[model samples]
Every structure is written in structure tokens, then in C-alpha cells.
Target: MVQFSFFVLPLCFLFNSRKIDNENIKTLQNDSFMRYINLESLYLEDNKLTTIHPGTFSGLGNVHWLGLMGNRLQTLDGGGICHDAPSIRWLSLGNNKISTIEPHAFDCLSQLSDLNISLNPLQSMDEDVFEGLDRIKSLYVYTIYYTDFSTAMFDNTTNLDHVYFSKFRYCNFALHVRHCEPNSDGISSLEHLLARGVLRVCVWVIAVLTCTGNTCVMIGRSLMKHENKVHSLFIKNLCASDLVMGVYLIIIGTKDVVYRGIYNRHALEWKESFGCQFTGFLAMLSSEVSVLLLTYMSVERFLCVVFPYRDRRPNVRQAAVVLIAIWLTGFFLAFSPLIGHGLGYFDSFYGNNGVCFPLHLHQPYLRGWEYSAFIFLGVNFTSLLIILSAYTGMFISIQRTRRSIASSFTTYVGQATNGWIPDIQRKNLRTTALSGSMYAWIVIFILPINSAINPILYSLTTRTF
Candidate 1:
């Protein structure tokens, strides 16, 4: 068969004596390049090509580089493109939809020096994927978070001089390999999860404040008499929710101490452990329940302020039922990823990052992105809208009441200003960095501070402080 008898659409560019460049090429039939025997490099980058039939490059024995980045290829079975390409040194399949690479996929590329499989949504890598590539020096893979490598995945490639991954924990697997892309995962450096002294100090401080402040609020609210005793129960429950967050923070902080300088050695194990997952569950439950409780509190305040004559406050029994339902809903939201979820749940939804929270905004193609999106963009987003609507209505009501009853703006602004002006201002701490290492700090720092502030914000008008 004439190998180039038919040309691939989008006109593949064959470069100076040694290469073929396919610009937006769509497909490559078997034996497509049988005549390109002397070609040294092939660039099919950023193309719409989906599959590269095995034996497609059967006769290209001298080819050195193959660029398959930004394509739709999903899996690599054994010895596909790398077949017959013994001298191939650099091969990139980055930004593809790859999920699986069968054993000995690179079995023939013995002289391959640099292999890039980065940005591929790899599900799992078999221990023998790189079985025969003992001479390879650099591995440009990962930034794909959910994928777990078999402990022996690098047993053959132990001489790796350069390695890159989404987690610093991965370094432990490639032991003798000295140079690793990320020395630290921001919240955690090679030395500690709370890498910065400031972060370490902040963790303990916020945990103490959150636990202490919420405890004080609960005790004070119970001891003092309020017009709405049922409402007081709701406040007590909110404190309990915040207290869980405090406990979660303390656990993280304590582990930061226990594992102090050897975080890298234990990073992977810690994230995969049951203790981490439970704290994650604790965090999700506390976060969702707290959101619901705040929405409830805001809705009640909106009603009382906007319609002074209407009796909308729930009785003790009603409040109890509502609180129970809220906690139950939170449990459902938090535990949904762990129970009866489809195969994706097997990946350990919360276990991807060190903190055990499944917020993978920074990690590429992480498993459970659908569920996380549903929670962040679906449930939590809806809750945010409700809370905003309640607060906005309450603010509008204050304006109207002021117009009618001549109440001054000073009264409300003064309260907010007074609550905010002393000793602290909330920092948004959002990051623009694409690395999961950088973004994990937002979760580690911001959420705990919010928990610490909740009781203080709630008790601003009271003598509890």
C-alpha cells in the first residue's frame, strides 16, 4: 500500500528532511507514515486527532520526538506509537483526555530521554507502564491530581533526573531522583504543611478563637434570657457547627506539629488516611450547616425587619425540627461523595489534596469534579443567593423604616463599623495561581478565620464579648 497515497486533512507539514508537522490534522490511519522512515520528529500538536492506530508509525525507527498535546486521545494501550521508534527521545501527550496507560506502553522507547504526559486526566498508571524505559531521565507528567500511581510505577525509571507532579508527596515514590518540580505545595513546603511560620501561628490562633468564642457564645446565650428562646437554640446550634470547624482546624494544626519537618515522607499517607477523610467530612458538614443556619438567621431577621407585624418566628418545636433537618441535609451533602456514589467515589473524593477538602479548582481533571461543581455551583451557590437575598431585603427594609420612622443610617452603619473596625479585617485570600499547591492556602486559612469571626460577628450587639 502507498503510505502517503491519501493525505490527512488539514495538510500535515513535513519539515526539513527530518520531521512531519500536522496542523489540525484529524486522523491517522494504520501505516499512515510507513514511508517516513528517515523522519526524526513528528508534531501533531493541538490537532483534532482522536486515535493513533497501533503500527501507525511502524517503519519510523529513527523518529525522536512525537508531539500529541491538546488532543482528545483518552487511553494508551501497550506499545502503540512508541512501537519501532527506539531512538525517540522526547514525546509529549500533554493536555489530552488520557485516563489510562496500559502496561509497557513505552516498552520500545528504550533511549527516550524526555517523556511528557502532563495535563492528561490519568485515572491510574499501571506499575509496568514505563517498564522498559530505564534510560529515560525526565518525566513531564501529572498536574493531574486524582490519578494515583502504583508504588512501583517508577521502579524501572529510578534514575529519573527530573520529575513533575501535582503533589510534593509524589516525590517520595521517585526516591533517588533528586530534582522535583515543586519543592513545596504552598500551605505545605518540603518541611511542613503549614509552611510559613505566619500560617502556623494563624492556625492555632484561629482554632483557639473559634473554639473559645463559640463556646462562650453557647454558654452566654443559654444563660441569658432572650425574647425568642427557640431562636436562642438555633444560635446555640450555629455555635456547635463553628465548633466543629475549630476542632477540624486544631486537628490539622496538631498534625502539622507531629509531622513537623518530615511532611514529605508522610504527605501521601496522611491524605489517604481515614483521619483526613473524617476531618474533611467534618469541614464540609460544618460549612454547609453553617451556611444553612446563617441563611435561616438572615431570613428570620429579614422577616422581622421588613414586616414588623407578622409573626414568622418558629416555635421551639419548629426550630428544633428545622435545625435537625439542616444538619441532616449537611450530612447528606458532605457524605454523598463517600457513599454509594459511582466508581469515581472509589478514588477518595476528599483524599486528593493534603487538606482532604475536595476543592480542585487548581488541579486539572480531578475526579469528582462533577460532584464538587454541583456542591460549589449548585447547592452552595443557591444557598449564597438565598443569604444575599435575605440580607439585601433586610437592608432595604432598614431604609424604608428609616424613611417612615426617621431612623438614622448612623445607627446601622455604626453597628457594622463598630463590629468591623477593631483588631481585624477579613482578607479574601483568593489566589490566581493555577497550581493546587498555591490554592490550598485559601481553604486552610480563609475558612477557619470565617469560623472564628462568626461568633464574634453574631455577638457584636450582645455583652457576650
Candidate 2:
């Protein structure tokens, strides 16, 4: 029952314990751990110890796990440090100042399974460095400096199943092994980089254009002297949605740039931070809001065209309510994963690409989120149908109205103005047709194009790319 933690001293008192968890202890003498002969595990990580005395772990026969990560140890001397520790299995000397290792330094620990010396400044690596780790299964050796991984570097590690090295290629063997990069999703680093480079350029350009186009639309509508109140409102809402999309694109584009340049592979900072989840949620929210607003605008236009007698315009208060509802629904849908109703969990490794992506419908164990995906598809399809039907009805109504007017005018003018009236009616009809054609293009192509590009941009970001 001896509990020691965080800089506890007196080797005599800790000798009775089977585990010693005195991490962050700056001073560890050669004999400090000698008295703990029965110790099964020792955690001395995050300390200031600069070296390991020849016999520091001489008598810890039963120690199975040794965590000396985040230390200042410069060299690991070849000695009988763990000669008595026959049961040692896991050793973590990661994030240390170990620049080199003496031959057969760990030869005593023949049963070691995992050796994590990652983030160390080791000058080189060879078979002698892992002389005793014949049974090592997983080795993590990520570092800043370059190691040419000579033929003999892994000769002693016959049982090694996985080796995590840097993403940079030093040799053909490095390429064959699993390498961790900023993009940890399924895609390879080269493919990820290629796609990201292209996306970085495209997204920024699209973002700038979207922002400018949407802003101009909003400003023009606002400055108009006799703006069509109903049409103006719909345009404003559409512009607002596009603006949100533009902002989201800008953020992701900037992140891509940073990841390629300054941050490199470490740019996956979003994986462990709240930024990943928040940004992902916000992006989804913006997209959903834009889609819903588009639907509302199309239906509003439809009502105005079909029922021209009544006032189909919504006031500011009514508009506010609808916008609020749309936003609230979007928010709920976007963040449902946080409440266990969607993906059923908030996974930082959602796509394993370092980007906090929305929960994919194809992901496993999705409770309500799977159904939510179907709902999204249904709404989008229904909205598109409404837009198409509305625009079609408008075209038919305009054509009928023009023909009726032309007939009445021809009848009233007899033969004197019949030719002139027909010509005027034909010109008017042409103008209406042209206008409808442009509206159809916007609905059938432009709107869908904008929405389509966003997902395409995202899909290009394979696995966390």
C-alpha cells in the first residue's frame, strides 16, 4: 500500500513497494532504484536526469515497464542496468536527449516487446542499438534528424511486426513500412500532399470569388432605391448563405497552407484540440443553413409567381423566425454526435486526416446520424424538385399571359396595328424566355455547382488530408 508520487524521496521507504511512480524527479542516483529489488514497474518520465549510471537498474529483477520519457539523458551506456530484470517488456525513453547508445545497452532485457525512443536526437541507428531487443514487436523512432536505416539497423529485430518511422523517405524500405504523416487517413503522404496543394490553390480562389460575389449581391440589394421587397429578401438570404460558405472555405484553405509550410506533419494539432471539433461543426452548420435557405428562397419565388394576387412577402419578424429555425435545426444536426445520438461518439480520428471532419454516414455504430443522412438527402432532393417545378410553372404562366395580351391587342386594333402588335408581343415573349433561361441556369447549374464543389473539395481531403 506504499503510495509514492511526484518527487517522493527515501529509497528505503519505496523498497517495500512493487511499483514506483515518482515521475518528474529531477535527481536519480545510481543507487536510488537498487533498494527496490521487488519493484515490478517504475515510471520516472518527465524528469531532468541527464544520464543512466552503469548499474542504475541492476537489481530490479521483476520490473516489467520502465517509462523514462521526457528526460535529458544524453547517452545510454552499455552496462548491467537491467541484468536482473528478466520480465521487462515495455520501455519508453521517448522525448529524451539520447544522442547515442553504447553497444548492447539493452542486451539484458531480452523479453522487451515495445521500445519507444521517438523524438530523440539519435545521430544514427544500427543493429547494435537494438542488440538485446530481439523480441521487440513495435518500435516508434520518429525524430527530427535523418537516419539512413542501413541494412543492419533492423537485423536483430526479427520479431518486429510494426515500425513507426518518419514520413520522409531515406530509402526504399522506408516507403514500404507504415509511416505517420500529417495526413494519417488512408491516403499516402504523397497523394495527400498533391491533393492538398491543388486544393489550397482552388479553395482560396473559390473563397475569394464567393465572398466578392455574395458581398456585391448583398450590397447592391441594400443600396437599391426601389428594391422588390420579396425578391430582395430572398437574394439577401441566399447571399448570406453563400457568405457563410465562403468563410468556411477560407478557414480550411488557410489551414492547408499552414500544414504544408510552417507546421508540416505536426500540423495535426487539431486532432487533440477543440478547434477540430468546433470547426467541423461550424462548417456543417454553414452548409446546412445555405441549403435550407436555398430551398426557402426557391419556394418563396414559386409562391410569388403562381399566386400573384396575394402578398407572398414575409416581413422582417417572420423572416427572423424562419432563419432562426433553420439555424437551430442545422446546429442540432451538426452537433448531434456530441450527444451520442449521431455518430455515438466524438472521435478525434473521425477521418484520421488531422482535420476535424463531420461524422461520416458510412462510419460504424452511427445511431441517429445514419438516419440523419437520409433526411439530408431527402430534403435536398425535395428542394431541387420544387425549384425546377416552380421555374417551369413561371415560364408557362408568362407564355400564356403574353399570348392572351397579344390576342386582345390584335382584336382591338383590327388590321391597322395587327402586324405591329404581333411583333411587339413576340419581342416581349423573347425577353421573358431569355430571363427564364437565365433563372433556370442558376437553379439547375449554378446553385448545384456551388454545393457540389464544397463536397468535392472535402472528398479531395482524403483521410485527414
Candidate 3:
């Protein structure tokens, strides 16, 4: 069979380029588009033009706003036909090299409502510079060279309502504050830099080691054979939980190392992003799962030690069900914040550190602290007690049995039939001792090792960097 192929071309829509502001025009006089009578706004900012002809703007009969900001204009001459242009409502001359504006520079801008002449070298403003602007409502004179302007500057226009003088450098001798927000956090950039750098490096190192070591343990367990498959299954489950914790640590470390502090490094929009919240959720989920799994493992080993001959060991299917339950319970614990467990629990910008940390550690967390205390005492503390007491009891029971057997053996040293214990009984005792010791090592070291390194993990998780 032969197949036919057809090609289709997508339709494209075009727009008028003249309607867009042209930033490449260096001189307004040389731009032919200035005569486009339909143009309503002209932006000639960030250019190299040094002079404005009185007739330069006359062709823009319908232009209602003009921007001449960031230009090299040194003076505004009366020859400009800006006075003859149509009703222009706004004009900007900010960030210019202009040092003077002729007496009647804006005498004909009767309809102008907003005037921006900021960042100029005008040492003083004569009332005549704004004589004809009667409808002006907003004036921006920020960062001007004048120490003080004439008091009558606004007397000619009574409609002025908003005047911005932010960073009025000439007014430093007076009691005026120019900028306030950037320094609101109070920590100097140098101090913040040092703090963030040290923290990021530490977190990165911990994350890499934890992730690598736990991954190796998990993979090793998967490939290795176990004499007791049931116990091996539980060990694998525990390692899986640790793997999640390692992944969580890696995410936190990368976020801090790449983003640094939110105060200076990230934009304001970062607070609305999901990066921080997702990292926090993973961290919480992994942490809760690790603890819950450890508790479950301890209980399972405790049962095995306490009931050696009952054949109570769980099968593979039963272990799977139990592991699922453990995971679900961990999910519930980590998701408490979504139900309003504490205010700002999921907000990354709530505290001084600007991170999504536990509410119990932030300010005004009296109730949160109380809740955390209850959980610590009831869950973590109970688990610790069970693990310690169970292992101690197992060892004690073994020691007592050893003593009783030794006494029996001594009493029946010469009796031919009395010294004979079944080979099965000896094997059972040996198996029990080995199993107990294995569990004791895991309970005493494996679980606590993860818990002991928690401070390092949490230090990075709670901080913004």
C-alpha cells in the first residue's frame, strides 16, 4: 500500500509595529514615525537626544503622553512647540542630564495632570517652570539636586495631591528618610552572606552523604539473601523509610544551596511558588515515616522475643498490609498542617527565617509547642521506652535461662541420662539468641543513628537558605 503525505502551513497574525514604543530611536527629530497622527503615546526614553525643537513634538497632535526619561538632554528651550501640542495629560523627564528648564518650558501644558522631573540637576525650581499647568495632580521630584525648592512652587497649581520625594539626596541635611524598605530586615548583607554560605555548604554535604549511604543500603538489601525472609522484609521496609528521608534531605539541601536567602536572592513572587512547600511536605512525610517505621520494627522484634515458640511470625502478605498501614499513618501525621493544625505551618515566608518550618518552632507557638510536647511524650517517648525495655528484658531472660541450665548441668554432672537435652532444644536456644542479638543491634544503633543525625537535617530544613 502507498501512503500520500500532505503538508499544512499554519496561519500567522501580524500587528502594527508603530503602535509599540520604540526604544531604539536616539533622536526624536530623525524618527519619521513621530508624524504618525494616530499615535496617542510616544516613548522617547533612554536615548541620546540633547535638544528638543519647539516644533519637534508639534506633529504628534493626538499624543496624550510623552516620555523623555533616561536621555542626555541638558536643557529645555522655549523654542520647542510642546506648548502648541494637543492636550498632553502626562510628561516624564526623569533620569536626564538636564540642568535647567527655561522659564516658560512647560507654560502651555494646561491639561497636564502628572509631571515627573526626577533625577535631574536642577538646583532650584522657579515657579514659572510650571506656570501653565493648572490641572496637575501628581508631581514627582524625587532625587533632584535642589536642597530646597521655592515654597511657591506649588502655589501656582492648587490641584497637586501626591508628591514623591523618595531619595531626595539634597535633603539629607534635613530630617527626611529617603528609603526604608530594603533595610527593614536589619541584618547587613555581609552577615547574611556569611550565614547563608556556611549553612548551604553544610546542608549540601549532609544531603549527599545521607542519600548515597541509604541508597546503597537499600540496594544491598534487595540483592542479598536472608536466612529468615520475614525479618529481612521488615529490614527492607525500614531501609525504604530511610531512603525517603535521604531524598527529602537532598531536596532541602539543593533549595538552600541554589536559592540562598529569600530576603536578597529571590524575588517577591517566590513566596507564591510551590518549590518551598513541596520540599517541606516531603521532609515532613519522610521524617514521620522514619519514626513510625522504627516504632513498628521495634514492636515486631519485641513480639518475636517474647513469644519464641508460638509461631507468631507474620507472613509476607501480613507484613505488606502492616507496611501500608504504617505509610498511611505517616501521611496523616504529615498532613496535619493542611487542616489548620497551626497557623502559617505551610507558609514559607511566615517567620524570620522565611522558610516553611514547623509552627511549634516559630514565635507565638505556645499552643503548637504544647501539641508537639504531647506527641513527643506520647509517641516518640513511648516508642523509646518499649525498645529499651524489650531488649533489656530479652537479654535478662536469656541470662536467667543460662544460669538455670548451668545449675541443672552441675547437679546432674555424673548422671548419664540427666545431662542429655534434646538437640532440637539446643538449636532453638541458639536461634533465639542470634535473633535477639540482631534485633538489639538494629534497635540500639540503626534507628538511633537516623534520629541522632536529625539536628543536622532539621537545621537546613528550617532555614531559608
Please, what is the TM-score per model? 0.72, 0.46, 0.43
lDDT of 2 by residue, 1-465 (tens): 232322345555344344433444555545556666767777777767776655566667778888888878888764635564556898888998888777777787888998888888887554577776878888787654443454466667777777766532222232223433423322114233214344445566767877777777678667864334654564466567657667666666666565554333343344435565565566556656766765675566446556767854688678878888987887786676545422434443322233344322222222233433443445544554565565566556654654443333223212211222222233334323222223222222233236324322222221121
Highest lDDT against the true fold, candidate:
1
Error of 3 at 220 (Å): 1.3
- What's the lDDT for residue 206 in model 1? 85
lDDT of 3 by residue, 33-53 (tens): 343556667676776667776
Q: Score candidate 3 by lDDT.
A: 0.50
Error of 2 at 11 (Å): 56
Go through the candidates in order and give the clash count of each.
Answer: 0, 2, 4
Residue 415 of model 3 has an lDDT of: 23
